[model samples]
Structures are given as structure tokens and as C-alpha cells.
Target: MVIETLPARLDPEEAKRVRQERLERIGSWLLPLLIMLFAIWLWDRICVWNEIPRYILPRPHVVAQTLYTDAALLFGSLLVTLKITFLSLLLAVIGGVGLAVLFTQSKWVEMSFFPFAIVLQVTPIVAIFPLINIYVDNQTAKLLLCSWIVAFFPILSNTTLGLNSVDRNLRDLFRLNGATRWQKLRHLRLPAAMPYFLGGLKIAGGLSLIGAVVAEFVAGSSGQSSGLASRIIEAGYRLNAPRLFAALILISLTGILIFLVLSLVSHLLLRRWHESALKQER
Candidate 1:
């Protein structure tokens, strides 16, 4: 006997609806971008009228000139800052995820270590920077530690919440399937936790950048292996307001880029099957 298989069918009207929706979304973004550009222009005009001194608040054009003239230096230092942020984030994810798993596995461990994680989160990194620098002996390592401390708590707390927030029914189902604790964790909890994990990652990305900048400020590491934070400090000290603003702009742009990249990654990972990511799109 021969068997026949049919191709899936799609409604033309549904396809057209989706296309229109996408176009509407694009238009929404375009309008906001245009508005932002107009606002920048208006701000520039006001600054020009006020005759703001370059030493105080430089003209946007002057800041742009400084940025373009020192593009190479700025870009190179940006890479250093990016590297430290990325590395610290990687370490934070590993440490946080591992600890979260441990906490979920043992109530005693959760009770013991969770408070310390809270402490780490609440304690100002500025206050600890001196201690960390003294103990680490390496300036670079000290900066990384400071960044890691800033980034780690979110991942730990969020992941722990995600891991434990699994539905009781699901847990029972897994147990009914003769699933071991490890199997349940691998198959059920981890997938359930991805949304929370990504949320924490987004927050952690920004925090990592802040931590790196703050640590550099505290450590006064502005010579070799220094990042954009040091450049901003140097510019400020030299009374070059335009250069300082340019550096600040670069840092802000870098942060936005990091956030956008991570958001894209999260969308790619979760858009297919996850309700939280795909609900609006659907």
C-alpha cells in the first residue's frame, strides 16, 4: 500500500496581516529615532545660544570633533573596557549559576550562602575596591574582581529563584516519569529558568560596565591596561570638557550596544517556544 502526505497550508490573509504588523513596528521605531535626532539638534542649538564654554560644557560639534580626532585611541580603550566587562560577566555567570544550583539542591546551603550574596549586592563596591586592590596585588585582577562582584549577585539571585520556581505539578510529573534529581534539573528546571537567567544577564551586562568603570576610578588605573573610564577621568582632570563628554558618549553607546546584543540573543534563544518572549510577536 502507498501512503500520501500533505503539505502544510498557510492563509494568505494571515501572511499579509503579519507583514503589516511588522511594518507598523518598524515605523514605530523610525519615528522615535527621528524624534531623538531632532531633540539632539535642539539641544545643540540651545547650548550654542548659551555660549557654553568648552571648559564647562563643550558644543556638541566640538565633542564630535574630539571623538573623531581621537577615534583610534577611544576605540582601543573601549575594547579594553569591553574585554573586562565580558570576562567579568562570564565569570559571574559561571559562579552564579553554580551557586544557584547548589542553593536549590540544599536548603541548608541556601540559608547559609544566600545572605552573603545579599550582602555582596548591598555593600557598595566603592567601599570594597580598596580592600580588593590591597588583597589582589594586581591592579587588573582587582578591577575584574570588583566588576565580578557587581555582576554576580543578580545572576545568583535570579537563577536561584528560577530554579526553585518550577511548578510542583511539573516536579511531580518528572518524579512519576522515574526521573532522577539530575534529570529533572537538566530537563525541566533549566529550561524553565532561561527567561529569568536572561533577565539577570541583561541587568548584569550594564552592572559589569558600571563596575569596571567604578573600579578603575577607585584604583586610579589610567596608564597601561586602562579602559575608557580612565580616559574620561584623564579628560576631566585636564579640563577638556568636550573630550570628557565624548568619552561619556562612547560609554553610553557601548552600554546600549551591549544591551541590544544581549536582547537579540535572548530573543533568538527564546522566541521559538517561550511564551514570555514570543507572546507579543504572536
Candidate 2:
């Protein structure tokens, strides 16, 4: 028998869908880049047209040049901030997840303590920093505590929600099969909670960075080991607009990088089995 040949041309709808997917894939990144460049060009033109002094609004190129020239100082500060951020995130994860597990095991414990978590979350970090600053003598400890407070609640709440959200049918089935609490937790709840934990991780990552910077601003610490926030303050004091812009750019970039890294981690962890990470036919 002769082998059947596949069609050379795709159906019209299939061809249209393929083209759309290609366009979307390209446009997702390209459009944002184009818009960002346009915004920068507009900013430069506005500064030039208004005859603004460098002390007021430095041109993008000047800010870029400042980034290059001040790389040593800025990068060092970045390291300090990053250290606080990462340490805080690590602590938050440990505390949050541990607490969530306890809450899942005991409703009494959850009711007794969850309100305190809510209080911490609702209260602004600025309001809480003074207490942290007063109680914590070491500069790094102060920063770490502040960041941890900011990052902790999301993980606790999200993971708790996920753990509690197991299907009733599944629960009954496990019970019928004589599964113990530990078995259900390990085989069912934790796996189901993975997506929620990952989502919270992404949020906590950015919040940890923000908390570190904000804590720096509030503490107003100054020295060789101070963070980008201190550099921003110093730049403002000296009317170093270019340097201030550069510092701001670094903070923005750091937040973006944290989010991207967390998102990648989430995707990698969930891609094989989680519905959210699975590729959709559509």
C-alpha cells in the first residue's frame, strides 16, 4: 500500500491561530521594550526642551553614565540590601510555612494566632519599624526583622488557604482508605498547596526587597555598608540627580529580577503536574 502524504497547507483557522500565537509571543516582549524606549526618549526631550538643569532631572544617558561611574559604590550597597532581602525571605518562609502547618493540624491554634498575623499584615511597616528599630540594636538585625515582617503574612495566609482547600471527596476517600493525618498531609495537602505556596513566594520576594529599601529609608543608616536606599538619600542631599536616578533604576531592576526568578522557580516546580503551569491547548 502507498503511504498517505500529510497535507502541505494547514486549515485556514489553524494557520490564523498559529500566526496569532507567533505575534503574541513576539509582541509580549517587543512591545514593552518599544514603549520603554519611547518613554525614555520622551523624558530626554522634555528635559532638553525645558532647559532643565542636571540637578533637577538628569537625562537618561547621564543617569546611565552615572550608573557606570558609580558601579563600585552602588553595587556594594546593592549587596547589602540583597543580603537583608534574602535573609528576611528565608526566615519568612520558614516561619510562615511552619505556622501554616501547625494551623492545619489544629483549629484551636489557628484561631488563637491567625488574628495576630492579620494585625501585622494590616498595620503599615512604617508604623512598625520604629518598634523594630528601638528593640533591635544591630543595623542588620533591624533590617532583617522589618523585611521579615513585611514578607511573612502572605506566605502564611496563602499556604493555609491552599492546605485547607482540599476537595471534600478526596478527604473522604483518604479517610475511607484509613489514611492517617500524616499520610494525607504529605501525599495530598502539601502537593495541592504547592501552587499557592509558589504564588506567595513570588509576592514575598518582591515585598522583601521593598521592605529592605523602606526599612533603610526609615532607619536612615549611613556608612560604607549601607544600601541603595542610603545612596538615594545621599544623592538627594547633594542634588546628585543622575546618581539618584541610577539608584532608583537599580532598585527597580532588583525587584524585577526577584519577581522573574521566583516566577521561573514556580514554573519549574509546577510544570510537570500542576494545572496552572501546564500548557493550555488554547
Mind giving the per-residue lDDT tens digits that candidate 1 earns over 137-183?
A: 77678889999999999999999999999999999999899998899
How do the residues 1-282 of candidate 2 rate in per-residue lDDT, one tens digit apiece? 233774789899988987999999999999999999999999999999999999999999999999999999999999999999999999999999999999999999999999999998999999988888778888898888889999999999999999999999999999999999999999989988899999999999999999999999999853543899999999999999999999999999999999999999999999888888887754
Worst 10 residues of 1 by lDDT: 1-10
Q: In order, how many clashes per candidate?
A: 0, 0
Candidate 1 overall Cα lDDT vs. reference? 0.88
